[model samples]
Target: MTTITVSPGDLPLQCLYRWEKERGPQVYLTQPTGGGAVLDITWAQAAQQVRCMAGWLQSQGWPQGSRVAIIGKNSAHWILADLAIVMAGYVSVPIYPTFNAEALAYILAHSEAKALFVGKMDDTANIKNGVPSGLPLVALPLAPALAALQWADLVKNNAPLSGQPVADGDQTSTIIYTSGTTGKPKGVVHTFNTMAWGVSSATHRVRMDVNDRYISYLPLAHVAERMLVEQASLRYGGRIFFAESLDTFLMDLQRARPTIFFSVPRLWVKFQQGIHGKIPAPKLKRLLGLPLIGNLVRKKILKGLGLDQCRIAAGGAAPMPADVLQWYRNLGLDLIEVYGMTENSGVSHSTLPGSRQTGSVGLPYTGVESRVDVETGEIQMRCPALMKAYYREEAQTAEAFTTDGWLRTGDKGQIDAQGFLSITGRVKDIFKTSKGKYVAPAPIEDRLVLHPDIEACAVTGANLAQPLALVMLSPDAVARSQSSEGRQTLSTSLQLHLQAVNAMLEPHEKLDCLAAVTTAWTPENGFVTPTLKVKRNKVEEVYAPHFASWLAQGRPVVWADAS
Candidate 1:
């Protein structure tokens, strides 16, 4: 076994201290607002704001360990509040900005956050739902219309913490809420050291230099972003630029020109769909197949997306269909697949450079021990970066760790003879059909998702005779269905493409019944995780009530259920 050593205080905060000492007030964050660099904050300047906020918190007179939540989109203020919460010696709970009112209420109440910092209140209704009783919230980027107190005002007016600064190495850093298969949310508590360890471990695997620029678009509340941005950025002294909205996301990306870009399968699917729609796949493939045209076409496409200089492009939070992986690789964009959970501080393994393999999540990072439980086939990990416990849930905490402390990931995976790990299906996700045959949905869905039409899918039939799939088609696929239906008249010529996909799939994994919900699966809707993986059970419930007749039909391959 190989080993990697990390010295104490060598985390993100250490990076900031280095930057502050070496280069005074260099730009660390920026967002293009109006004219010149709308918002830019240097390391020292940002630290002053954080210290001021920390002072304000000390003035609040709450318990030192009370959970403080951040309720808004990404901003310089958002980052500062997160670091300030830690500086004030409080646990920071970063909530998804898109969570609906009911979910907001549930999380706020469950986490017992004493105060909140809300940024970008465009979704005020959702914000209101999570507002705790008697708890004060300071809103950043406060507009005239929003009723929340201004976070900037609070920080500006309050004095900085007078005494010794908080540099606790083992304090509880955060409690990130992840939606459960049971339709509930569990808060995963991680210590500063655990998160710091994750960043350091990933640095060795990815070799993140000080020059790396990360676009922080994924919800910071997620383990993926928290470790990468909060922990890794802090340790490596990289700049973080948050996307303003969909309108400016591309512009922001072009402006930041990030060295490392990480997005989920859904976003990647959208990008692929955009390119496919612009130039039909068959035509583009034929053009690229030509010797002279191939390199030029790839270069043009990469430049158009501003990924010509991207060092690493990664996709995770869900299994990436191999064909999509191939499509990008063909265009000279090296997108690698990664696999991990919140329990492992977001990244347990990643496909290392020069060792890329499609259909496999790749080798475990240094110091992370992974073994498949022979009985259940579930992957278990023992690492220095493992979470302290599920917040306030003692029984759950005890259940998570083995007697010797290996964390049960609950994800079923297999390691090839050479140690490349491929996740198959979740132990909790695999269920028996009414026929009593155990069905692993992820593998089946992975096969079906390779079809160009499918955007996202979930397979469910726990007690039914056979498995069924609920698919959300890509925008292009939906548009093509309109024309395809006009041309054909039978199940052979369909009004919807789900039937076509069902035909394309190998029998059991095919769609048993299909319906056009036409709604996107997103973090706010509770159907997807913050990192954009479908919460399979939530997806099943949302569509299951509409699939009664299909289930009654014993999972026969068909179009919509016959009323």
Candidate 2:
């Protein structure tokens, strides 16, 4: 699996010096901090911390295309300051340590980011008050700032050098931002020849390999987990691990036993409500429609979510919930679902490996090129890793391309006739309903978040007069309201699962109401946005004044009678 000709003088962090001159430590990454200490990172300590953090950012006079940024959470020095901000040629942006500080003071003063690398979390000592008091930072010892300079204090007495060696089709190498879910978040750039022609146009559109491992928890500051962790793990030389918190993500997915596990559909509806909170959806569909107890209850629920040696388990950003993709295809985990947008660098479509659909979003994407503007079915697309704009804004990158260019993905879709697609929502999450009927609340909160007592839901209404969902339950349904007979049996089983999800919605997107809040719209409550989504305009401005007496008393409504 070696092919070259990648050129802005050849880099993508020299694919960790072609895997340390071809496989050396036999392990690339496996972080599970101290108590379980294992840092691993090799390919010669990740090409000697990408040449001592690109030779101390070229002895700090910060020049070349200069931009830097790199916020926090998800580490290995958040991929060593994203490969020393592209081997110090510079320009990396990233921010999303759950943004706020006014969206990192507008992307650290709109990517004029001279430097910053913050990652360690609990908000890296308030990221230098969200950077811009003459921006320049270097903290990084997994960021709980013990007087900064950490990456072992900038390579204690630095050396292991290298100067220029960057090209794999170079253009700008990394920028990623957009999870602003309609408002601030913008900057979406890329280049190492548009991410090595999007990692060989997605390994020739999904026939991926190089013994693919991918288990790096999402928010590599996004763009489908930085094109599956920094350009398909440097164009598929794979193996990356990370996750060990969310209470030991299934024992760090059975100690990094990954083959390809990327998540999103709100963590695949909390792994199908953690397998219907331990079986019982008609006995987990009679043990997955038997015939060998359906591959041994889909190999014991993918070996209890260590994802039984994954082998491709995708789901990306949002829209996916065809009953959680037919309960991960009745547990055989071909979970698939993918559609893209970091302003088109992640993908243009997917859902292929053994044709999948469960309410589409798959197809196209081999050097992508799509359409659907059959008058606002929106979608458009074009990709060559799209972005090359939007960073410095230029009128929202000239209204996100077109006039013979494509890329307008403000999400609303169609496409069919075999080129899949589906989507049908997010033209600013659609609204209207005093009877002008046009509710589209993500297919009724993807069918009331496959009720295992939902863990997140947000279907607000625009000019009001209908659609309402809000929900945030599940901490095992608010730890069953710490008993008074488990809060009258979780308010009579969430009012009989919101009366069986409003008798399967449609009377003007029924769900006419349902409050239930306790606060799990996480990213430390700005009502979610660090890839866990929800900031539906800050949960309609922190629950629109406690949803005004339950929308002037119409139906459902209950966060203890709307507060």
lDDT of 2 by residue, 1-563 (tens): 23323443224666667776788577676677857776777666777776787788878877787788887778766886787777767888887776767778777777777878777677443565656675667777557754456667676656756644674454677677786766777777777676666656666756565676766767787878877766777655677888756777777888777878778888788777777777877888886777986888789788877778777777878787787787776677777777887777776787787654578877866768788787777788886767788777788888887889897888887877777888888787787866788877887788777777777888887666777787888787677766668766766776777788778877777766777786577876577777787878878876777666876766464763337
Candidate 2 lands at a TM-score of: 0.34
Estimate the TM-score of every prediction. Answer: 0.91, 0.34
Q: What is the C-alpha RMSD of each candidate to the true structure, in Å?
A: 3.2, 22.2
Worst 10 residues of 1 by lDDT: 486-495
lDDT of 2 at 186: 78
The lDDT leader among the candidates is: 1
Clashing pairs in 1: 12-234, 12-235, 434-464
Model 2's alpha-carbon lDDT is 0.73
Best model number under TM-score = 1
lDDT of each: 0.75, 0.73
